[model samples]
Target: MKSKNSLIPLIFSLIFFHSAEAICKPRGFDYIQPSSNASTSTSQQQQSPSPSAPAPNQVPSSPPSTSTPISNANSNPPSSEPQPPSSSSSSPAKTFTPSPAPPPTSSSRPLAGINLFNQPTPKTEPTTVDPAVKKICDSTDYPTLCLASLTPFLIVGKTDPVSILELAIKASTQQAKLALEAATKLASAPNLPPRKASGLSDCQYMFNDALDNLESAMDAIPSKDYGTVNSMLSAVITDSETCEDGFTGQSPLAEFDDKLRMMGSNCLAISSLISPII
Candidate 1:
């Protein structure tokens, strides 16, 4: 009975030693852990269940409880140790360098092309002028100026020819009056140059006369006195030219003076068209 009990204890010791040695033993690894873990898993599955076997989740732990005591004993140099590789081998078995920590992303600035002041312009279609306006303006000294001045106004009674003559007189009258006012202001300025002062004074008188002529032309249009209207309007060209001729360089009143001359020309031409209507 004593011998049987002693042998039974020895058998249990051997079985425990083998089982712990197999679990804790490290494979000849190549700095990788997956293959070793796979083999270990397969080996664990094949083994029959013993009450002393480790749990499944504990399989991937770095070192088991059985390895701690053995590792301390084998810590001495191999020449002095003469230990089983299972204890010391676990340290160098598997290594993974955590994939170089995925290269850092570069930062970017906000977009510089955004426009806060985006505004659209209003659209305007070309003005469609009357043929009578075109015809009347075509006969003038400045047809473009004539069309621009005369095409915008309408006659109360007549749509075209009568309206053309009336608008012509009206345009000349307006431009000449504006010229006269601007010239009068310049003439009154202190320390005015001799030639400019003389020119401005002359322009003032000429524009007054031009306005009077435009008034007479407006009066004649109702009576269809085309010849008298032509004579009066044709004289306005001479008046504007005579005023401009006094100035050495460009006149201060050039804007008004030049436009008045063109309008005078437009009046003369439109009036000529109405001579046969008398």
Candidate 2:
């Protein structure tokens, strides 16, 4: 029990000692607040604008920013210059000095005596039959005979009929020659072929008929029997064509063809002259 009482006093003493230590601690710490106030006052003094701030505002009454004079600046903007006129109006109008036109080159010159600038081109020099051709016409009547007789032979070949026919036509003279030439050409035509039974009998017949008519024609000319000559020629022509449908290649026909052509030029020449007389 005594020990318990002493223990109680000891606890009370500890409580009292704690209370006094707390009071002393507050007394020692009270000085720190004043020091903190002093530091706050020093900060305020450092942050405040000094006397120099008002002096800068007060010293700047010299000139406004906009009113300042600019140095080394252009007074005016650059301009474009006007161009001079090509021709002066006061002076006489400038003459255009045109280069002279070159003369016609030799290559451009007209053929023969024809002048490009002058007289209406002499009607293309009337395409006269060649002298050689005229001589053929004048020499004999056989030229027509040859042309007429040979047409049958030619037509039997594979060459173009139109061109062959044209050649025969260009060589033809007199009614008999023309008829014979036409008949032979048709009978012997390449396109027509050797369809006849007698091997170009029609062509041969026509050629023979032409020959007969021409003979009769020449004979009649002496007597001035123009009618007989005409009749004979017509009959021969008809007879010659009658056999055309029957023509088939045969009978050494090539020989007869050669003979016919050999004599045609001479025969045609004489016949042509006689025909004009008739």
Candidate 3:
């Protein structure tokens, strides 16, 4: 019985060994190798990109960031295009028109304070005479004498009627002054006869009257009093004629006679010219 109990313990020991042997045995190569290869492949799949994914060398494409700026620039293209034209249209200064200049007017009056007597007589004949001068001269009793006397004054372009009358009165006064000087010289002559001295003294009185009348006529011209001018000029003519008549019956003071006759005739012509105006 003791020996049987010892065998029984050995049998339990053998059974435990066999079970350990079975539990401790290595796995098959196929199973371990296939599992290792599958694990390696799974790690490679996780580490590397798929074929459909982008390459490492290529950059990833997303919606273009430049599109927003490009769209904003294009949004107001028409608005920017019409700004220059609107600014140009608002300015009307480019279409300004200029005004026309006024026409010049002609003057009828003579230059003031011109002295006809001091002015030199023109050597050459004028191409034309004023119609007003011709009309005034023609109205005189001695048109030829009036025209000839006034031609020297009119040639200077002083065409005013008042200036013409002033010139005539000045000429008449000058003649009277010359006649008075001649009479005074004859009256003062040594060894003078009574009859000759009497005629010369009468001539002096008549010349004084003529000078006074001519001066009065000159003063009347500025007043536009042609009637008074006519009366004074008529008196001048009468005084000159009376002076010439005083020398007539005597030896005829030839120089004094000529001057008195010329003075009387000029005064008569000037009076006729003023008659129509009066």
lDDT of each: 0.70, 0.46, 0.63
- The sequence of per-residue lDDT tens digits that candidate 2 reaches over residues 113-217 is 233123111122223333433344335444344333334434333233223323333332233343444445445556544465244555656676666655665
Number of the predicted model whose lDDT against the real structure is largest: 1
Model 3 collision count: 0
Each candidate structure's TM-score, on Cα atoms with residue i matched to residue i, is: 0.52, 0.23, 0.46
Instruction: Give the alpha carbon lDDT tens digit for every residue of 1-278 in model 3.
Output: 99999999999999998898777656762323237648955555445475356446544444324533346654654464444455546656566578886654324334332321232222343456578777765655555555555665564667556666676677667656766776786688799878777788888898898888888888877776767777887777677667666654543445544444554566556555555766
Pick the winner on lDDT between candidates 1 and 2.
1
Q: Write the per-residue lDDT of candidate 1 for residues 144-174, one digit (tens) a residue.
A: 7776666446554454767777877776676
Model 1 misses residue 20 by how many Å?
Answer: 99
lDDT of 2: 0.46
**Which segments of candidate 2 are over 4 A away from where they belong?**
1-126, 129-195, 247-278
Q: Top TM-score: which candidate number? A: 1
- Candidate 1 lands at a TM-score of 0.52
Ranking by TM-score: 1, 3, 2
